[model samples]
Target: MFSADALIQTSGNIVGGTAGAFLGGYFAIKVMRTQIEFQRKQNQQEKEEQYEKTYWLMKLVFEGLGSSIDDFQKTMNKPDIDDKKDYPYLIGLLKGTLSVSKEKKELINDNYIPKDIYREYLAGITLFNSCEFIIERWYQTLHLDNFKISTDNYQFKDLIVYGNGMRHIFNEIESIKPIKKKVTTTGGGAK
Candidate 1:
């Protein structure tokens, strides 16, 4: 038969061991949950940052292209300039210089832009470049004595196509543009 004191000591040890195990498990779970919550918050913050970067990039491209398009249209609408006498000057004015930075280009090139916007961005670039080519070809006609640049040139057909295509792309970009958040304030008085 076991001694009474030894049996009580053994019982105390068993209870202490079980309680220790439960407490340790509880703490382990709490730590895991805390770590998981922290990771989730970190991931959400990163996504928000990326969204801001993409929005800014798109805005920059949109404004730049808008300005370039306006300039191109204004230069093309000039009716007073003599085509034959100011052909070179007119050619310079018609140059489609839609300059984009390498980083901005990489957004589309490297597939950073969303899949939906990707096709429109590429189409915009192609139309812009095509317009440039058409202007260059028209300018080269100066070498030919009979060829005179009038309101109607062979490139006009292609230019019209480019113009329509650009309009579509611009609409797409405008649709995706982020809405600016407005801040509201209550009445304030300094005095």
Candidate 2:
């Protein structure tokens, strides 16, 4: 038979063991939670940086393309449109606008755009289907074949699609308005 003191000591040892097990389990869970939170924060930061990079690249491409288009349009609207001799000048202007940098030219010849701006422009042209044919020809001239749309930047993709769609619809409506105006003017002239 066990003495009272021995029984008490055994009970004390069992209680101490239970408490240690509980504390150990609790601390393990706490450490795991902290690690998970850290990982999540790191992933979020990476995604934000990727988005910023993509946005800036798209902005550069848009600026370059917009400047070129404005220049071309201005040249086309000149009063010398009837002069057949001016055709070569127009072609020269287009060639100059479309010409890439030496580094980009080399990359194109090797079948790529070494910079993100050209990649975004290629992707944007595809997403904006209304301008695809013209942009496709331009892309082909550059020999840039690896243009892939990044789904990592879903918000940017959505913005591009929405903005392009709105612009296209607006253009169609504006075009119809001009046609209506012309018809009304002709009818009034006949009257």
Candidate 3:
């Protein structure tokens, strides 16, 4: 039979080892959760910034286009060009600035620009460097050729007024980003 003193010591050691393991496991989980939370917050912030940047740039482009379209409509309605008439300033502005605002230009230029035209496509390239701002040439049948023409004024106006639904979409996106992220992260929700 085992001695009573030996049994007491063994029971004490078992309890101590279990308590140590439990504390270690709890601390490790706490540290892991803290790191995960930090990562989640950082990612959420980046997503918000990206959404805002895209929203603002698109809004500016739409505004510029809408302004130009308005001027075009007014000019087209006029019977003849008057020597005294001061041309719409935006006509030159779009031509000069590619319809991009100063802030948008700074954002676009932050990405590295490569001189070589023929370079392999790389993932994670900024939207500015990757996307092309192109206006397909639309020939105005009667007198104008090689000019970009927008057919609908109302749609263009809407685009300027509302950056093509980005505002609403981003609002919903932001709501999801901030609230109940843990539930969403758990992968239980339907897409």
Question: Which candidate ranks first by TM-score, i.e. highest?
Answer: 1
Model 2 / residue 121 / CA error / Å? 9.8
Count: clashes, candidate 3 = 0
Per-residue error at 97 for model 2, in Å?
Answer: 5.4
lDDT of 1 by residue, 43-100 (tens): 8666546655765665555445445545555665687766567766655555534335
Model 3 misplacement above 4 A: 80-94, 97-191
Q: Candidate 3 lDDT, tens digit per residue, 51-166?
A: 45554554454344445444545664466644233232323433444425434544633233222211211211222221213211111121333332343544334433332233
> Where is model 1 more than 4 Å wrong at Cα?
84-96, 101-103, 107-111, 114-191
Per candidate, the number of residue pairs that clash is 0, 0, 0
* lDDT tens per residue, model 2, 107-184: 322122224234444444443333333333434443334432223345324433533543343344333322122123
Error of 2 at 13 (Å): 1.8
Each candidate: RMSD to true structure? 4.7, 18.8, 11.9
TM values, all candidates: 0.61, 0.50, 0.48
